[model samples]
Target chain A: MNVIEARHLWKEYGDNVVLENVSLAVKAGEFITVVGTSGCGKTTFLKLLLGVETATRGDLLLDGKPLPDEPNADRGIVFQRYSVFPHLNVLENVMLGAELAASPFWGRTFGKRRRAIREQAVAMLESVGLGTALLKYPSELSGGMQQRLALAQALIKKPRILLLDEPFGALDPGIRADMHQLILSIWRQTGLTIFMITHDLKEGFYLGTRLWVFDKRRHDPQAPNRFGATITYDIPLGHTDRTTLHTIQQSLGANHD
Target chain B: MKRLINQRPSRAAQVLLGILPFALLLLAYLWASELRLAANPNDKLLPAFSSIGEAIWSMAFEADKRSGNYLLWVDTLASLQRLGLGVLLSALMGLVIGVANGAVPLFRAGLSPLVMALSLIPPMAILPVLFIVFGLGEVSKVALITIGIAPFLIRDMQQRVLELPEEQLIKAQTLGASSWQLILRVILPQVLPRLLDAVRLSLGSAWLFLIAAEAIAATEGLGYRIFLVRRYLSMDVILPYVLWITLLAFLTDYLLRVLTRRSFPWYYNGGKP
Candidate 1:
């Protein structure tokens, strides 16, 4: 079954056009990267599929089911910034989704349900090499460690797919590369489908099983007072998908190192 | 010199160093004040430290003679009761209103300005109005403090909740969290640190307002007791109460900071404050 299928999706703000007709099908366990220039609707498309924002006009389905309007425990997302909850240790944050999933009511009353969730979170944190950091706060750790904590948290839920929106975008180049390797290794072991949105071509080429290009657009899709921008492109990866990204100086386009 | 500078003091030593100035000032000020107050016994406005000490001693003596000094504890408890109820009510109400304003588009647009305006008004200005509305009852004092502080807490919380990342909230929703669950889990946890600060700030402010509330409206509270002693020109009684309030505020703030540190050990604070 297709893990994700988005059809003729369009999202816009008052004067910004994020995506015109973004439609793609992600297969199970496939590592797909949506790449574009900065301000390209790559993030928006990811949001649409992840159900962060409503598509102005489109149908988004996951596992042959209707997409949800709000967040669920079924999809795990990691952000560019370490979006770890500052009030929780690495373990609690990782355990959050699983706890929610295991119980209809995620609270102190459901203490027994929490044990299973805790065990799962510990296992996922260990998988991401963060077993020692479980007791550590996100602040006490290095950037790489924080990112790993976030990954542990995301995977702890055991979501069907991982949605990453430039998860390493904010890190320094060296750290970013290290995180990419760590994430790739974790992804291999877990075999969870990954759909990451990035403007970085090199990372995209290195990581993606398949790639889609969202055309650049000068539109603000979330403008509340007014209808936003119009949609633009979905250029396929073509040979870039088959070859090492180093060979595609052309598709790298204006996107820099 | 560089090596000496590089050597950092231990935590205990650092705390000792921090208190050094206060200790020195306490000694120096004691001498200075004694000399000043000795020459000015007739000055009734700012009662002398010695007289206040005497007065506080006498009041304690009287409470012991009359009510076995359980009343002293009771009055202090009474004042704390008002503060506890006032601050808790304000914090919860403020957080609810502030979070509502932040999350809802129309409320965010409409209520933010009104809340800000209310926050800017001197809390004392509303004291008279509170008396008219709530009467000179315990409820009046508690209500006054709540009204005075809730707006600020609400405003701060609103701003914090508003700034919560769209990515994370939406990510959770996409994961299938209901709207209510999103709030209980994602939204609450994200804004908790700031909310804690808000609660602490309100608690301190509530006490500050409590003095005004207690003094004007009622009898049988710490503030009223302080006022009663002031009438007899007893500064010592007032000072201890003041000291007690200060101690409470300090302890509460310290406890909150510790709690924040304990909970969010990974909390890498980027805020300038």
Candidate 2:
């Protein structure tokens, strides 16, 4: 059964259409990676899935029901930067999701419940290689460590779906490689569905079970807003040949440069 | 050859440079006072340092003949109380209104213009109205400080709240935070240090309003005492009082800085809002 399905989803800000007729269905644990040129509504589509944004004119369903218009614990997101709360130390940041979920009124837990959340948070942090930095604040961490903390913070709620918006875009190459391994292992262990947006085509191919390219199918020079981006190519990975990869890379390289 | 900007002074040199101007000013005052006192046996304009010291000693240690109260301590206590209450109330109101205005569009549309208008009005101009409405008492003096600084605090906090990254809010929501939870857990912790900063920035104006209100109506306060002695041309008492108020203001600012550093170490280490 599909965990998420969008039926002709449309999102427009007045005359400026962002995503038009975007429709897709994702099985429960598919790893979908999206790549597009800047301003091509890749992030907007992710926001729609995360429920921070609503489809302007169509249905976005989760588990066969219309997705909530606001974010909830069923889905979690990580941004490229400012994903970790600067005020919270690493352990508190990871514990915050469960704290809010368990105690909605005060956003806190006490004694035994608090102890359990702490242990859970510690385990999550350890999984993300942040166990040693539990007491350190976000500002004290390097960019890579902060992203690890962000992932731990988001995953503590055990969301079925994780949304990552260029979460490793700012990392050094060596650090990003390590992060890619960490994320892949976590995904394999938990069977969590993931939708990641990346600017790097190579990263998309390496990480995703399926890849999507968002591009404008039609253009009007005089009325630029008249046309919106749609999924130009949806390719299943694992069996994709090098010639196809080269063609897609050549087509996207011009815009990227 | 080093550029001017690159030629920073050594530690000792920096300390020397800092004291130079103050030393010069003190010498100038002493010279002028000596000349005035030599020409006239009793010059009221600038008293000798010894006279000022004596005034401080008496006001601080000796009780008043009629009221039997140490005027300096009484005045300090009264002024501190009013300042504390005014600032506390302003901080509370500013945090609530500013967060609401920044986070909720409806609140922003309704209250932002009124806050802006309140901020623009010269607070002193409304002194008469405050005195009339609240009466000539402690309430009026406290209200003056609150009215004088609260709008500015609110506006500053609102801007700080607005300056927070949009991703943080969305990230908090995805973590299953309600709107109230978002404000309490996410927004409030971040805004708190900025609020402290805003309060520190507004302290100068807060002091100005406090003195103005006390001068106009109060019987006992730093401002009241200074103005009361002005009629007699009592430069000794007045100068000491002014110095004392300056010292108090400096100490308050220093304490707040220490508090921010101790409580929210992340604020200083992180990027500016």
Top lDDT: which candidate number? Answer: 2
* lDDT score of residue A169 within candidate 1: 80
Clashes of each: 37, 0
Candidate 1's residue-wise lDDT over A119-145, tens digit each? Answer: 778888887778887776566677777
Stretch of 10 with least lDDT, candidate 2 chain B: B264-273
The C-alpha interface RMSD of every prediction is 4.0, 1.9
Q: lDDT tens string, model 1, B1-273?
A: 569869999999999999999999777867766676678856555555667677666655566665566445667788989988888888888778888887777887898888888888897987888788878788888888888888988988898887776765665654455666667777776676778877876676787789888787666778888887778765556777787778877887899889977764434365210
What are the C-alpha RMSDs, in order, of all predicted structures?
A: 5.5, 1.6
CAPRI rating of model 2: medium
Tell me the lDDT of candidate 2.
0.91
lDDT of 2 at A19: 93
